[model samples]
Target: AEIGKGFLLPSASISSKTKEQMPAIPKEIERAEEEGVKILYLTLPTEITGKNGRVNGLKCVPLVLDEIDAEGRRKPLPISASEFLLK
Candidate 1:
């Protein structure tokens, strides 16, 4: 992931099990910038089973398409699923 105005990118391999790119909400990003967090690591959540001891990757439903109007206009829409993977 890239951060800061210079867009310093991280060199890390995301697992294939990762479903989607975790989005940084504008508000949170602004706050992080204001707080002087030039580089931030966002950890995603993983699914656990049984006694919640073992992790089984992450479950996610990607946002396919944004809602459209009859005139083929786009509208501001929120993300659908909240699935994530912590690594």
Candidate 2:
């Protein structure tokens, strides 16, 4: 998140179990209709326009959810984020 801000880009972090975890998702995505986010780092499944070369119509950057299991082992879980591509 800081990386974007360091570049002087507006960035926001949202939490969700899925795409509809909150009512604000749609509204946030709606901003895409105008001067919206150039890129989306989604932790959950969300809809995309599929306009660019973005694989599976998902966000550009995929985040890893590092979690600990019952055995107290480290695990890297992918939260369904896809490859980042631009047209």
Best by lDDT: 2
The residue-level lDDT of candidate 2 at 86 comes to 33
For each candidate in turn, the TM-score is 0.23, 0.26
Q: 3-87, model 1: which lDDT tens digit per residue?
A: 4446443223222221233264667655754655533233222353333675534442223334578989543332456455422
Taking the candidates one at a time, how many backbone clashes does each contain? 0, 0
Could you tell me the lDDT of residue 43 within candidate 1?
26
Q: In lDDT terms, how accurate is model 1?
A: 0.40
lDDT of 1 at 79: 44
What lDDT tens digits, residue by residue, belong to model 2 across residues 1-87?
334545554554433333443355686665642443443333443345453664433343355646767888544345453544433
Please identify model 1 stretches exceeding 4 Å from their true place. Answer: 1-27, 33-57, 71-87
- Please give the lDDT score at residue 80 for candidate 2: 55
